[model samples]
Target: MASLFAFLRVISLLKAVWTAYSAFYLFRNYLAARKIGLPIRIIPISHTNPFWMLVDRHFISFIRQLPFGHNSFTRYNYRGWELADRYFSHHELGDAFIVVTPGRNWLYIANPDTIVEVFRRRTDFPRCLELTEILNVFGPNMSTVDGLQWKKQRKMTATCFNEQNNEIVWSETLGLANDMINYWSSKALLKTVAHDTRTLSLHVLSKAGFGKSFKFEGHDERKESSPSTSYKDSLQTILENCVLIMALGTKFLENPWLPQGLRRLNEACNAFQKYMTDLYEEEKQAFAEGRTSGRNLMSSLVRASQDEAKTGVGLTENEIYGNMFVFNFAGHDTTAHTFTFALYFLAANPQAQDWIYEELCQVLGDRQPDEWNYGVEFPRLKRCLSIMLETVRLYTPVPVAKWTDTRTQSLNVGAKTVVLPPDTMVIPSYASVQTDPKYWGSETLTWSPSRWIKTSNSTTANLEDEELITPQHGTFIGWSEGSRDCPGRKFSQVEFVGTMAVLFRDWKVDPVTQSGETIETARERVLRLIKSDSAPVLLLQMLHPERAPLVWKRR
Candidate 1:
């Protein structure tokens, strides 16, 4: 009894000490934040703190139930806070503000001009490498590195996203989308829309990135194929359990005593690594033999790096593997989530579906799907592209993070020059800036694809001649802005447009109505689901998309 009391006393004392230290630390950060001359909001915990992130939802929920907890700092200091807060915080604290926490001062900027200045000054505001270091598990790819290393990787990777590769993306997407539509149409009501889209995206990436193609298998039709089928399975497993893999790591998960699921993840990691290694050797051998007919991303990347090696600047084998993984990571989930969102949005809004269909009919006419050339037809699919753009504007998959590392920096925010202290995280307020009415106009929150289209005044002008509305410099950063922007921007665009062209050209989708529910009610339910259920896991995506099934039919 005495020992138990003594242990309890020690625990209490430790908690008191930690609480005092945290208070002092937060106070110090508050002083530093005030020096920046921006509105300062104090938060108890930093969003990036690994411990807090694990239990944030539950803790925040508990906090909200307490008196004065709804407006507490815990609310804003959680992952995906931007989605919940939106432009409200900016509205309260002007275009730029400092979120002061014990760990660091986070400067969130919503101003367009200020954002442009930040993007332009890359050296002054490099990416937060510490945050991205988790991505280095494979190796230091472009997403995980900065400076000259990033330049080398960027140059090599950029070559892979050329017109030829985009043509492949377009062609593969059309085929996969047709298959997906057939699968969906066959079902009475499709619940696995999100899962199916993700599968389609993964298959597309597999083909476009590695010159390996797989048949689009629906939910019911899914089964292990040939010996190489593990390649797809492994990649899918890695992506699905990416957070766990990143958190615990492959070595830790590979332990024999861990759970069966974790063991499978470990197996997937080993399998994927081996697959990449095999592909790397093959590509290197092919390059050595001077047989460079392969137009896939892997061939282009390997060849480009090899060509650069003659000048003593080439990606290492591990770097190639790292980049391949990053490409798969970036290309697959982002597009898949965007597709799911657009599909849900379109399902709810039939008029928008009709709008895309009308453009498709006018652009393609009686041309068969095979005859739809990338160079000729892709440019004319303005409405299809708009759907992608509009979807991303509302829910940007990967919100980029930049920081002033170990050096104090000055940034121009409107007329004021703000001095950011060293170790300040500079996050572009993507949700706020993209949806701000000042730039996107009044229906900023509304997912209206037509907002991006501007019809030409010339009476003789063809539908293909319609131009896309260019938003203010920093307002629309779906693919990001400046040099470090997504290199696969056009790749994603091509894939999305092709999918849209196929899915909406001759078909329409509707939300599966519940018993005694009207079509309008069903539409509203889907809209509510989209608004409420969507959140960032690896990226912003619909959480329980299967909860809201969809139905497809010929228009």
Candidate 2:
């Protein structure tokens, strides 16, 4: 009884100490934030704190139930807060503000000019490697490095995403989309639109990224390729359980006492690592033998690294594996989520489907899917490309984070130039600026692809030319901006356009209306689903996409 009482006393004392320390730390950060000369908001816990992230929504829910708990600080003290808050916070606190917390001060900027300056001065504002360290779970790759190491990886990555690779992405995406459409058409009402699109995306990545190809399998049709594991199964499992893998890490999940699902994820991690190793070995052998027929991303990357290795400036074997995983991770989920969003938006707005179909007809004419050329027809499908752009405008998957590491940086925000302290995180307000009415017009929130199209009279007035409208530098950072923009920007665009062309050219998707529900009501439901049911797991995506099944019909 004495020992129990002593233990309880220790716990209470420790809790008190922690509370006091947190208060002091937050106060210090607040003082620093004030000196930055920006509007400041305070939150008790940092959004990046892993333990807090795990319980953020639940804790906030409990807090809101208490008196004086429902406030901006509680609301915004979570990861992916930008998705919910949007321009409202920026409106309240001007174009720039600091969110001060015990962990760090986050400087959120919505000003386009300031954002452009930050992006251009990469050294002044470098990537927040601490936040992105999870991406190095496999090994140090392009996404998780900086300085000279980043330069080397960037060069090699650039080579892999060349025109030849984009062509592969285009062809492979078309084939996968065609197969997926056939599978979708067979169903009366498809609840697995998100799942199917992810499958299509994974297959495309497999073909283009690693020279591996898999047939598109519907939700019901899928079977494990092997009793133990298959490449597709491993990759799919890893991607699906990304948050779990990232949060708990592979080492912890691999423990034998873990739950069955997590153990399976551990198996997947091992299987994927093995698959990458085997591919790396094959590519190395191919290079040694001078048999350079492979043109996939993995092949290109391996060849480039080999040539550079002779000069002591190439990616190591683990680095190659790491990059392959990162590319697959980046290319797969980002496009798949965008595809799901675009599909739902199209289903809700049938006119948008027709808009893309019109462009497809204009570009492809009498040519079959096989005859469509990437270099020629892809550029002509402006409406299709616009759909991708507009979808991302509304729902950016990966909002990037930059920081001033160990250096005081000066940034011009509106009329004032402010000095930021070292270790300050500078996040571009993607959600706010992308949808700001000042730049995107009054209907900024509406998912209208036509907004991106501008028609002009040519020299002969009879002929009209249409082109995509270029938004202000920082307004539409769908693929980001400046020096360190997404290297696979064109790769994703090619895949999206190819899928849109194939899917909409001959078919249109409509929300599967519930019993006694009007088509208008069904469309509204889908729109609501898109707005409310979306959040970031690893990236922002529709959470319960299956709740709103869709039907594809021949137009």
Candidate 3:
């Protein structure tokens, strides 16, 4: 009895000491932050804490209703830009502010000039690898490294996203768009737009990205070609259960006694590994025999690595596989979700669809899908490109995350130089800056794709001749800005333009509505559904897109 009491006393003392230490650490950071002269938000728990994620939804809702509430709550899940704007209306937080959470300080910057400076000075403000470490589940890829390692991964990866690969993407996208149109046309009300878009993106990535192609099919269509697991099935499984795969790891799936879901995940991991290994061996053998065609990005990467390996500077087999998976992860959902948003936007705004159709007609002039030359026809599809840009502006898929170097950093913002302490996270709020009224004008919040189209110099010209407006540097970072900007920008653009041209040319889409509801009312409801349904999963996506069914009609 005496020993038990003594041990309990020791435990109590340890808890008290730990609490005091945490309090002192937080107090010191708070004082340092106040000296920096930036707007501050003090939260008890770090935003990244998994435990806090459970209550985040309720916390955000409660905070928004508070009198004169600041944008501190914007750190929670989706619609961060909208939250930022509301807070901006209520406070004078300038272009940037400090979010002091627990023991860390997060510096959120929305200023265009400051964002440009941050992107340029990569050495002073490198990415926080800790956040991106989840991507290294396969192996060390481009997104999870910095300095010489990142440069090495980037050098070979950038070469794969070239003109030839883009041409393949354009062709594959056109083909898949036709297949998707056919599938949608057969249905009275299409509820699988998101799934269909995901499949389309996966197919494009497979062919143009990995030298593998599959026929486009509907969500209900199931025709397995592989003996064990289809490549598409494996890839889709990986994408769907990415967080689980990252947490438990690919090897965790090996235990047969585990839960059914986890066992399936294990099967997926094994299937995908076998697929990658087979492709790697084939490519390597082709290279060894000097018979390399280097048709797709994967083939190109393999060829490049082989040539570099001779000089002892090339990527390893595991590195190649890791990067291929990264390409799929990065390329697949970003394009897929963007396409989903574009479909909904078009369904709501028929006028925008009409504008794109007019542009397509003018550019192609009744040319068959196969006849449309990527080099010649793709350059003229500015309207399609504009719609994509506008969507990205409103809904950035991947927000940029950078951190201050070990040394302290300072930046000039609105006649004041703000000092940042060491290891502070510097996140460029793409959503906030892209939609800021100061940069984008009064209708910044509105979804008007026409804003991206510049009038032609010739007064007699029609819409087709208008040029695409290039937003000021740092103002529009849809594909991000600077040396680390997404290398697949043009690849995404080409795919988007092709899909838009094919879909809008011969078909029109409108939201399914009740008999009593008017078209304008239906449009408003669809827009609301989109805003509400969109939540940040791995990327921003329509969580319950089926709530708004779309009907397709021949134009």
lDDT of 1 by residue, 1-555 (tens): 999999999999998998888889899999998777899888888787878888887788788888888774755878888987878889888999988888888899999999998898999999898887777657779988899999999989988999988889989988898898988899889985888888999999999988889899997888753323589889988887788877787778868999877877888888889888888888899889888657888788889999999997899988988888889888988998999999999999999999889999998887767879999999989999999999999999999989999898989999899888889999999999998888888988888999998877667557766899998899988888899999999999999999999888888999988999999999999999899888777689988988888999987
Ranking by lDDT: 1, 2, 3
Q: Which segments of candidate 2 are over 4 A away from where they belong?
A: 1-10, 61-69, 225-229, 257-259, 458-464
| TM-score of candidate 1 against the unseen true structure | 0.96
Estimate, for each residue in 1-555, the C-alpha lDDT of model 2 and write its tens digit. Answer: 999999999999998998898899999999999888888889988788777878887787788889999787777887777887778888888999999998889999999999999999998999999878888768899889998999999888789899998889888888888988998998888985888888888998988988888888887898755313688889888887777787788789779998877878888899999988888899999999989757899899999998888988789888998888899889989999999999999999988887777777777876778888899888888889999999999999998899999999999999999999999999999999988888988878889998998877556422128878889788888887887899999999999999999999999999999999999999999999999888887898998999998998997
Candidate 1 weakest ten by summed lDDT: 221-230
Scored against the true structure, residue 519 in model 3 reaches a CA lDDT of 80
**TM-score: which is higher, 1 or 2?**
1
Per-prediction backbone clash count: 0, 0, 0
Lowest summed-lDDT stretch of 10 residues in model 2? 455-464
Badly placed stretches (over 4 Å) of model 3 are 1-25, 62-91, 223-227
After superposition on all C-alphas, the RMSD of every candidate to the true structure, in Å, is: 1.8, 2.1, 3.3
TM-score of candidate 2 against the unseen true structure: 0.95
lDDT of 3 by residue, 415-471 (tens): 778888887889887767787777787888778999999877687578656999888
Off by over 4 Å in 1: 1-7, 65-67, 72-75, 224-229, 458-462
What TM-score, over all chains together, does every model reach? 0.96, 0.95, 0.92
Pairwise lDDT winner, candidates 2 and 3: 2
